[model samples]
Target chain A: MRALTWQGVNELSVETVPDPTVQSPTDMLVRVVRTVSCGSDLHLLGGYIPFMRAGDVIGHEFVGEVVEVGADVRRHRVGDRVVMSSFIACGRCWYCRHEEFSLCDNTNTNPAITEALWGFSPGGCFGYSHAMGGNAGSHAEYVRVPMADHTAFTIPDAVSYERALFASDSVATAWTGVELGGVAPGDVVAIWGAGAVGQMAARVAQLVGAERVLVIDRVPERLEQVRRYVGAETIDYSTQHVGSELLEATGGRGPDVCIEAVGMEAHAPGPDFLYDQVKQQLRLQTDRPTALREAVYQCRKGGTVFVLGVFAGVVDKFPVGAMMNKGLTVRGAQMHGPRYIPRILERMERGEIVTEHLATHVMPLEEAPHGYELFKDKKDGCVRAVFTP
Target chain B: MDGSARWTAALVGALGIGGASVAATRAVQKARPRPRPDRWHAVTVDRAPADLQGVAAAPPEPLAALGDDLEIDLRPAPGDRGTELRARARRPGLLVDADVRDALRRSRSLLEVGEVVQPDEPGTTRRTVTSLPLELAIRHGREGGRL
Candidate 1:
């Protein structure tokens, strides 16, 4: 099977790799139909994560057809059109029982690495680095999905494959942010970054009844998308002061919830950005937390700040004093697909949430390396690059 | 070498290099784990302490996977966490920490979820020069975590 593989830092190639097979009773083989690039993929491509290996297939958000199943797979059969969650989880674990599927105890085959790094491993992620779980990603013709019954969902007839693909990760991740950030009816929400995840977070906040939302970004294309498609006000941080615009939007009380969707590889504004970049390059800090710091510092007193970004390790300047003085709540997590995916799919089927517009560039799997180039550079207004195998 | 042998050799080589880098660069979890003295491998399962001790009679695969010369004890965890299953080798040199930790983890998962979920085998990589360290950490990782 041909798959897009991570070759090295800032390197990718489409290579002929071994086809996957179902090895566990709860496992099923997914014939990849559409796999797309994500902002999180940039960390891997840039070698910020440090766990990636050459020849490891690289893709996660996808919609596919079930081509095979193991004996204990009771929920799905071959030929079923499905969307797979990026996170692999066993439905029977204590975390899964509590709807925190990302924290499942049994899924990450390589637990010690993360347990040693972050004190405990979360769960296995497809094509994510080995630190999460060294599962093969979906950037191939076929992918073996573990715990298929819990991780893969059947797409509704009303939902197109393109629309359902986002539900596998982005929309679910966005929903995790807004829902866990505790967005309430009529509350004001401010989101950092206007990428696909940020736009989806704005949409989820609106769906959950946040009356006013503001999306901040420097990219003119993304901010335009936020205003037009996401129906949120935009702040081009490159042009206007983000703090001033946020204050004006919320009428002085500040946003009730501030969500940071930009991860470690954030582009900072000026000299301070270089400070973080240098520290990160020097291995002093594994992440650049410029957006995260802004989210924490600018959030309203007693408000909630939710992190929806992919951060690897320590950062230089996090605003702990501001958080402590302001009495704010801070939280973050990987998406719990089963907890939010069904409703997201239902919304997609009903045309309540539309994501086809996010696929700015669509091409064959062979063009994945170029696609990554376009996405990593944020060129050609490429919100996301969708691939067909 | 045939394909399988080449792949295995490459993976082992990567693990070797990665193991050394993991110790040097990461600055924690010595690439080589020294078994702690008088330390017991323990897991807190959602099941009751009594149920875990009783399961040893008709041992599950997780417990059975460990040899017969193991001494096991179960007690309620503090703060209502769950039952704590503690075990150690009956003899001085029977099992290493990794073996005991791995067995305890499997036993807890088997009792709690009925089966230990795993990643796909024959996986997706051929193990590259750069992929070695993370690969090695993962290879030795099944023994729970630093905790």
Candidate 2:
């Protein structure tokens, strides 16, 4: 099987890799159909995620067909078209029972590493990194899905494979962000980053009764997509001041809720950006929280700030005082796919949300390295690059 | 027969039947123990010629073919730290040594899952030679429910 692997920082190659098989009782061997690049994958490509190893196949947001199943895999059968919840969740665990599938107890096969880093291990995920369970990613001809009955969902006939693929990670993550923000009727929601997740977050905010939404980004292409797909107001932070503009737009109250979709690799506006960059390069800080700082700083007092971005390791210069003084609530989570996948699929079927624009480029699996390059550099107006095997 | 005597006889018969059934079930289980899955062995080799620059790096094979059922992986550890070998058994009862089997299970859980899940709370990752009563008390204090 040929799969895209992380060779080093800024280095990716489509290499021949061993085919994946069912490894556990609840495992499913799925033939990869479509795997796409994600904004978060850029962190791995840029060496921000420390756990990635050379030759580790990279991809998580994908849709596939079940080609084989373990004896205990009862829910899915061979030839079933399925979309996997990027997170590996055991359905019977305590967290899963409560619908917090990302905190599942039994899936993170490598708990000690996370326990050492984060004090507790979260659910295992496909091909993110070893720290996230190191499950083979779906960028190949076939990938193994553990706890398949709980982690993989059958796509409804009404939903196309391209739209269903977003349900696997991007849409679910954005939905979780919207839920965490606690968007309400007539509320004004502000979203940072007009990338795939941010665009989806904006759409979900509207669906959840947020009357007015604003998407902030510097990229003209993404901001245009946000306007076309989500119908939300756009803010080009590079041209205009973000905080003052957000304050003025919300009638000086600021956005009722702020969503940070930009992860640790965010680009800051000026001199401060260089400080974070140098410190990050010096291994002084594991993440650059430029957008996070803005989200916290610019959020309305007594409002919620939802973090949908991926942050690995420690961060410095967090605005805790502002968060405390303003009575702001902060919430974050990895994509709890089981909690959101079904509902998002139903929304797609009902035509409440359309995600066809997310995949701007489609190519063969051999072009995955180039796909990553285009996505990482935000070149050629590529919102996302989907690869077919 | 007296009424009391008849009731007592019925109670005794019920107890005898229950005891006999339990004993028979235990005897059957002892006669045929449930089979255990075949445990494959795995180990880490600290390959030489290690250098910070231009290391002999290879991609981690997330999945490898060991047999029709078994899957194996040989990947460079995180950051090209070292090489790790992981193998799994498809069938029950392989010829791997007992100590090697336990080590493989522990390492595989760490490599695949992230942690070696403990059966109960109050259990330490450390190997302890504490008394049984202390261990039981610790487990009981942590959580009363059976894991």
Instruction: Please list the Cα RMSD from the true structure of every candidate, rounded to 1 decimal place.
Output: 4.3, 22.4
lDDT of 1 by residue, B1-147 (tens): 997887788778667756765566556445557656566778778766666667656656666677686777777888656778788888767877788888888887788867776766666567565464566567787875663
The regions of model 2 sitting more than 4 angstroms off are B1-147
**Residue A149 CA error for candidate 1 (Å)?**
0.6
The digit string of per-residue lDDT tens for model 2 on A1-389 reads 78888766688888877676665566778898999998888888887875665677889999989999988888999999899999878775446766888877567655445654675668788888766766677788888888888999999999999889999999999999999779998999999999999999999999889989999999999999999878999999899898889888899998899999999998868987898899898878999988999899999999999999999888889999999999999999998999999999999999887888989999999988888878888899999999998
i-RMSD per candidate, Å: 2.0, 15.6
DockQ of each: 0.56, 0.02
List clash counts for every candidate, in order. Answer: 1, 12
TM (chain A) per model: 0.99, 0.98
Q: What is the TM-score of each candidate against the true structure?
A: 0.92, 0.74
